[model samples]
Target: MANIDPIDARILARLQRRCDEPLEELGQHVGLSRNAVWRRVKALEERGVLVGRVAVVDPDAVGLGLMVFIQVRAGHHSADWLEKFRRAVRAMPEILGVYRMTGDLDYLLRARVADMADYDRLYQRLIARVDMGDVSASFVMEELKEGSALPL
Candidate 1:
């Protein structure tokens, strides 16, 4: 990966805030020419600094209003068991994210659902599918902040 200099950082900042900005507009914002900005953006992509652009969607608008974080601990932590659990979680559409952790729990899962009833059914399915000996989950009451921007 290329080291992000001041110019590169500026380009990233502008791009993060407005991905649809034209090359010339981005160049003006970053104090570079149109072609320079285009090359920098391409370089960033090549270096894997800029991954992919995506549109942020409203969960409530999509009818998946409830947010949940589920903690899971398995009966054992063998590699095969972990892989199986991961594969099982990956297949569930309701599960938005999954992370293996260093804390007491083996895995942390983020899921979205319509309501408590929906979550209950999802939880039951998870219990049936995962090789978990312990499971705990908490519902998100509020979203204080949510964003993917990283300060340069």
Candidate 2:
């Protein structure tokens, strides 16, 4: 990350909590003028520090309470297989996040499903498109922490 001053850090910290924080309030919090704060915010965006903001929704509220993490091991480590795997996983709306990690597991997929039946349907669709050597799944029983705050 680019080196940010104390004022910039304060701006980001507040923005992270509420991206659309009023300029006057944010300026008062960081001891700067509203226009100055606006300038700095624009500069931060230009530097790519502040990308974009979106609303955070609860999975349970959307009827996707169950969280399942699926680890995929490659059946065939080839270009065509990888491309198909990527496409298959991306097409599933239930699959919220996918990651290619540097460990034993080749890919990790985080899926938000309604229940076991929903997850099974997703699994069947996934396997029908791309092959997996080993697929392991874990259900989250509880969510202890979920936040978008980054350590500043």
The 10 consecutive residues of candidate 1 with the worst lDDT sum are 1-10
- Model 2 residue 134 distance off true place after TM-score fit, in angstroms: 1.2
lDDT by residue (tens digit), candidate 1, 49-113: 99998888899999999999998888677888887887889889999999989977878999999
| Residue runs of model 1 more than 4 Å from their true location after superposition | none
Candidate 2 residue spans exceeding 4 A from truth: none
Root-mean-square deviation of Cα positions for candidate 1 versus the true structure, in angstroms = 1.7
**Considering summed lDDT, which 10 consecutive residues are worst modelled in model 2?**
1-10
Model 1 residue-pair collision total? 0
Q: Report clashes for each candidate as comma-separated counts.
A: 0, 0
Query: What are the RMSD figures for all models against the true structure?
Result: 1.7, 1.6
Task: Please report the candidate that would top TM-score against the real structure.
Answer: 1
